[model samples]
Target chain A: MRLKMDFMGLSLKNPVMVAAGPWSRNPETIMRSLDAGASAVVTETIAMEVRQNVRPWIYSKNEGYQNVRLYSDHALEQWLIFIRQIKKEGGTVIASIMAHSPSEMAYIAKSVYKAGADAIELGLSIPHGEGVAVMGSDPDHMYNSVKRVIQSVDIPVMVKFSPHVTNISELAKVVEKAGASGISAIDTVRSIIGVDLETSKPLLATYGGYSGVPIKPIGLATVASIAQSVKIPVCGIGGISNWSDGLEYMMLGASTIQIGSAIMTLGSEVISDVIEGMDKWLEQKRLRAEGIVGKALSNLKSFDEIEILPYKAVLKDACPESSCETCVVGCLVGALEKKNGNIVYHQELCNGCGLCVSLCKDQNFELKWRL
Target chain B: MNIRDVAQRAGVSVATVSRVLNHPDQVTPKTRERILEIMKAMDYTPNWFARGLNLNRTGVIALLIPNIMNPIYTEIAKGVEEVAHNKGYYTLLCNSEDSKEKEAAYIEMLLHRKVDGLIFIAGHLDPDLMTRIEETRLPAVMIGKIEGNWQFSAVYTDYFEGARKATAHLIENGYSGIAHITGNLRFIESAEKLNGYREALKNADIQINPKWIIGGEETIEGGYLAAKRLVRNPNPPEAIFIANDWMAFGAIDAIKTEGFRIPEDIAVVGFDNNRMSGLVEPKLTTVNLPVYKMGLTASRLLFDEMDTLSSTSESDEKADQKQQIFLPLTIKVRNSCGHQDRIKAIFGE
Candidate 1:
């Protein structure tokens, strides 16, 4: 059976999605992503006024980074053309809006809704100056700001969250409370790659946001947490480079997965890989996209759900009767006692920590939760 | 020919001729027509060679620009034009396109044109080109940051300091492991920027991880690819700083695709303060390289040298020596670097 992914009340043919980025900036690119098998494509962030003279490169030395000015307000007519083209191409398009204020966001959101956009993605967070400062980062500000856009538009609204916050779930919940229809979890992480040691400056700008394979784990964890915390459908975003990565998000309760950097490197064709891989995995597992949503999340509880075994049991498990006993010898807990070529656990001294599990290669040892 | 001879041949007073040349509107149409007709009839060409010999001036200046496609260069060109026009010297705008060959070619063309001075933007001068420049002895000023010996005066941003400041900003905000995506390492600016990043890390006492550093073409597409490669690693750096704003956009886009949130999972910073940096959802915090000021300063220095050469009697042998100059840079803190609070409160941030 064909799988249907639902985000809030919106239904998607599949869980695979194209994240807002360069592809979203143009309708042709967005359609290409959809043609490649994406269920939906988020358009580029719409701003109040276009900027100019945005050079793409900056210098960095050793550990510093720099950023140069770039961006201009795109012509409204051009945006309309792009939006209209996406609709005509039989593609689902989500208009992503970025404005200076709540009022401005509301106006832009309303216009985008009227312009044939299937949905509106409010860019609640961005890595740059005005965006993060004005709309994102601050809970109260983001909540109120997103509320304004939600009130202005009748269509489903997805608030894209910034990952820079300490608690992504909290932010997601706040946006949901503010009446956002859905959440696009995790934007680019703020980071500095490294510096050119020879120059004593940054590699790009003196500083910049980082996104890539390295961020996938963080993206998955955030999506898992947000999915478990909020009732609103979550659109998982981040280092979705391939089908497996997209599946990981779906399993973690993501209704839709957005791919950005992968499309950048592998082109829109990556959407096929994500979709095909997801389909194959679903068929093999006898599950549908909807079934996969919140699957992994169901097994997850609060942070306390994780079980920690005692050190004594961990040490005994580390030194199994099998050939792998190196961990027992290295254990500082002194909780292991060897008997008949096997290590035995001392329950009284057991700490329930899983350090031994990390060290052991054998399946004989496992960490179980206890009250 | 001499001005007097040209006026006599044109059958016009010297004052009238001057007015016709400098301010044609001041002359009667018939008188101007007659003067132009007479001048053309006599093929009255001005003795520029003799005038140069007498005034010791070439009335030409060389302008070196990094890339024509870069708007910063265009802005610098405007500044240079403003100064050069006011100083009565023609500025020769040359695009290096960040290639050593193009830079050499433009330098050769400027030298062949016998420009009195030179303004070098962001490019390296090859040994042969440097020798040729030295042989020409033209007074020149270097604009933008460069490394090595300060053989000539230059006007540039302190890229090292800028990079350091940016890194420090990220570190101060609780970022421990940071990664950098850099530009072509051949340029001195790139090297200096790398040094600043290192300095910031050292100051923070953070052990540098070599795996995090990735270099690529200074394009948006390059940044996107680089970010993808870096993030795919088993242990990707928590934060990333890109070399340029355009590339940062690519990186940000890539990160978002990977489903990571900016500043939450990883933080990003960029350079150049390009206009687009501010327009994106998360405005980019970047360095303001004072390109216009550099252009203005370079032009002023070139004109000053030209004036000095014009006043001084130079033996033909002494005409082969060249000089250099340097400038300064500033940082424009914006949202991309996690300075949203300041920016939201005020536009200047």
Candidate 2:
């Protein structure tokens, strides 16, 4: 029963950590998260100036959270003090910092490394809006900025990217060439939580970053792309909630799992729960947690390389107890039909998409793969 | 029949026969004539692909144009094809329709087919396509302006200078109430043209009427609608400078339909001397963009780039060799701008 692993030369007791967010804002919370189970606590995004978040910034929708929160309000000197205190307590701290320009970014990276930080993670995900485009959105800008910071720092430099880009893998390759040690994806997706019925204004009052359960798939896809594109270690951070969600990211070739919105919604206890669940599952399987990383990459194939087996939907037997017509009405190809108070399957109309198979909870429809 | 057969029939070596077909002037007239006679007698035709294979080249260059329907691009295509044909290369024209996805797909397809080079005749800035081209390390030349920091060569016309000259002609004609119908301002070329118009009015000390300026789509209908709005104003302009010929054509039709005489009531000038500009009634007084010459230059530059890639070592600074060429523009004064009336009055009528 070993769960220890190595990511970007940092020894971690486990693969799960607190991603850069409000959860890792101060020294007390960082200490609490480290005590709870987080292997490494990524500090809240630190910038040159303290930011003032709008009132009522967080909006809760179904299974997701949209927030307009910005960088930490604490000054850079205060963050360095917090990092120094945490390092004195023997807790691994990954400092996350951002700035408006490359030189400014390099300056902050140097300051954080001097404060006894184990590593530096560059946060270049904020969209500038208006006429000023985000630095991460342009490859040349991102490459120059990353290079400047890496040149100024002695510690391993990691870059967390925004998902809203032309080609995520292409950007990943650009940053890798710029001497990044690892990559993290993705920042919260640009989203609008909801609109007020009375005033017709957005719930967050403006467009904001959306995170939580709904963004897990998007995060997994981005992480998989980045992992495959670069030789550096990858940190997956998106809609991860439970241990199973973290495991899914590991399977996609991520070396570590980062939980942000989930910790905000459920509290720091979520980190310990993830670590315990992963440990228990690995122990039951008689395997180490590190062994599961990148196991699914071997099965991953390009569209042209995938072997599509022919499958046809089949209905089990006519039952008088059948009262559900969900699959029949939900079939996109009209392959499922109701006749004589029972479901019937037309083999000719079936495209084998398996939509109806999931719709029928009575186990009436199943897509049998043709050998 | 192969060249060997012709050579044997003519009692000569195969090299002599090849020389006759390729460098006929270098060979003796007797040998060349004898080989030609035998080839004509045997009804033999030279293989185009075999000739290309001799140089280890594809002999095919792909040209991606934003729109094939636009006469400006078609004129460029014609120039490109003319040069390619003379250089023993075939031109593969792809109409991208100004879509980033379609341009990417075409670039992928062209790369797979092993084209010798690529020529992109885009109407707007294509940053994504430029990134894709850079990733593939392809020998390409663009026929439009790239605004950002890109490491590629481009050939462009000075839209700002062209607009300034077009507007200056109106001011020189004593028209103080000059207006402009601009193309979509989001594009750099359109914005440059608008700036040039402003500079011309500023140099002439004429106040620019903000209400007279209207942004229109780069289409005939956009021009027509924009002109309709302009003419509906309480005080319409005496002269208008349209961004492109297509929009100018539409503006002319709209002004005529509104019962305004061509040069007497409202003088109109357009940009991009389209082929139909001369055929339209009153003819179009437009700026000659030299699109065909630009296509020729871009194709030639791509060929030179491919040659540089083949000759130089991979470590050479060939990838960073980028050149920017700007061809000059001239205003084509026609009847639409009242220049013809001045000429006729000075001569006879």
How does the DockQ of candidate 2 come out? 0.01
> Looking at model 1 chain B, which ten-residue stretch has the lowest summed lDDT?
B317-326
Stretches of candidate 1 off by over 4 Å are A57-73, A131-134, A303-371, B1-349
Candidate 1 local lDDT, B1-349, one digit each (tens): 6568778887668988765554343354567778877777778765667756655556677777777766667878877876676444677788777778898778878877677788775456665676677567678776764545545555556788878877887887788889998887887777778888889999999998988888978888988999998888899888887887778888988988998877678788887776677787666667666566556656655654554555456643143333332333345666555553553323333
**lDDT for each residue of candidate 2 in A1-371, tens digit (9 for 90 to 100):** 36898999888899988888888999888999999989999999997555577778788888898887888987665677688788989999999998645755776787788778999988888532211234577898789879988877789899998888878888999999999999988888878888889998878766678899999888888888888888999999998889999988998989899988887778889999999999998898888878988888878899999778898887776744467678877989997777777767678888889887787677766778754
Model number 2 iRMSD: 29.3
Question: Number of the top candidate by TM-score?
Answer: 2
Put down candidate 2 lDDT per residue, B226-266, tens digits, no spaces: 99999888899999999999999999999999999988999
Worst-scoring 10-residue span by lDDT in model 1 chain A? A63-72
Clashing pairs in 2: none
Tens digit of per-residue lDDT, candidate 1, span A295-330? 887787667986544333423233434554655664
TM-score of candidate 2 relative to the true fold: 0.52
Candidate whose lDDT is highest:
2
